[model samples]
Target: MANSLSDRSSGGHQAPKNKKYQMKREALEQVIDKHISNIEKHSKKLPGTFDKEDIHDLRVNYKKVRAFLRLLQLEKDAGDLHISDKLKSLYHHCGTVRDWQLFLEELHDVGIVDQLPDCMHRWHRQVFTYKEQTVHAIETTHFKKLLHGIIKELPRQLQEDTVKQFMHQKIAAIHILLLAAENEKDLHSIRKQIKDIIYCIRIFKSDWGIPFPFRGWKSEKELNEMASSLGDFNDQCLAISLLQPSYICKCDYKEQHILRNLQINWLHQKEARQRQLLYEVQELHVEHAF
Candidate 1:
């Protein structure tokens, strides 16, 4: 995942014949069970505050489940997909907690905790409130039972040929997006696409060392770096957006003075990151074209 295992090539998705390539039903079932266990283990109603890393891992498992399901392209309106509505509900609820926690962490990283004690206190308490909602959401989710129903609907196996074709389509679409990207919002879209690819690739790695089907389609490591950069900017914007109004209603003169001093510096950093992301998006070449 760090670098392309296969040498770069154009216009093909074929894997070597001797390689083990199919996603067998048994393997898929095993992966689902493992992910379900991980979700339960991490979300187990712990007595103290949940560590940020644990929350992150829990959300990742949920993404893995959804990404694999999407890779299969199972349909709902006309076909055989029965992903639970509760699963989506739980994912979103957990996300609410993560957002508040991240905003708090970002503040600490920037040394704002001591400078803005009242603001920090409000956000810290807000994280607990969101976590309470997540706990209730977790209690209501029965992923084990839900996944059992899903496994029953799955096919006997998914061939590598089908998987490669889907990946090719995704790569080609990413190229189009790269060519068309014009702003920070477009870069955000690109980040989502990279994450989807990474999640699907990781699913295979969790079972077998399934070789990624395409070369020059940026390695997982490279995609992660880009995603990380985009995420930092996104988080900064969201934190400031949410915190501004809450602090604005205050009559505290000192808080107002501190924010006024920091606002320009923050805006400049955000703009610089935006431009860098745009350049990364524009760097794709013919080899990256599937």
Candidate 2:
């Protein structure tokens, strides 16, 4: 699976503190710092590769650095220094790419290429071309340079308050986004928004504590698992989005029936899980003494 997403911690255990934790944090930060340095060196000679790797590293380290800074802010623990938003946007870029990559992988998996009618096959190919064009646009611009500059300046920007503030803001944004989505009857959109919201929650959990508010919820582990399941459902929705309209049109009655069956099954599962999560999120708000 030639995935660019690399697990910096190979042991698959919670990152421990002490000498071992300190060593890993320092080493990972150095890896990030060196990646920035490499981007600067190659920016003039090469272009896309630096941007690509820089974005990947930024996403990889987002939770790590966020956790490190949160500990420093909330607990007086020692951790790596923070980076700038310009550097942070680099992570955002990789995120956009990753979402699309997931989309493409979905289309491929659902046998989209083979499912389309012969007459519409050419149009389906064009849809793939559209996806590729969006990707290339990001790779060709000064977007990469901007991300690199942020990376270069990151170590100096490490601050406890900054990371904590950002986390709070993200939580607020998720709440607001969900409220807006609840008005629409599109389960697809609701599921997508929930996925993003819960993903933000997971990022916070993986960095800080599972229950997110730390003081709330007995089933932090269960909440995390629910988010993971919802995310899988969102992935399927994204896959559906990527597939060409023509491909869908070409499906015979039986093929369409099968597709609908697959979709309905997923939606049923997604709704059940999301209801449980909704209750949990509300409970957290109450726990915060809201």
Largest lDDT belongs to which candidate?
A: 1
- Tens digits of per-residue lDDT, candidate 2, 27-131, equal 324445544554334333323333445544445445444444443333234433455555455445555555655654554565654554552454446545643
lDDT of each: 0.67, 0.44
Clashing residue pairs for model 2? 82-158
Best by the TM-score measure: 1
lDDT of 1 by residue, 17-41 (tens): 5564555567666766778678778
The count of backbone overlaps in candidate 2 is: 1
Which portions of model 2 miss their true places by more than 4 Å? 1-124, 127-135, 138-144, 151-157, 167-227, 242-247, 250-277, 283-290
How far in Å is the alpha carbon of 127 misplaced in model 2? 5.6
Candidate 2, residue 85: how far the Cα is off, in Å: 13
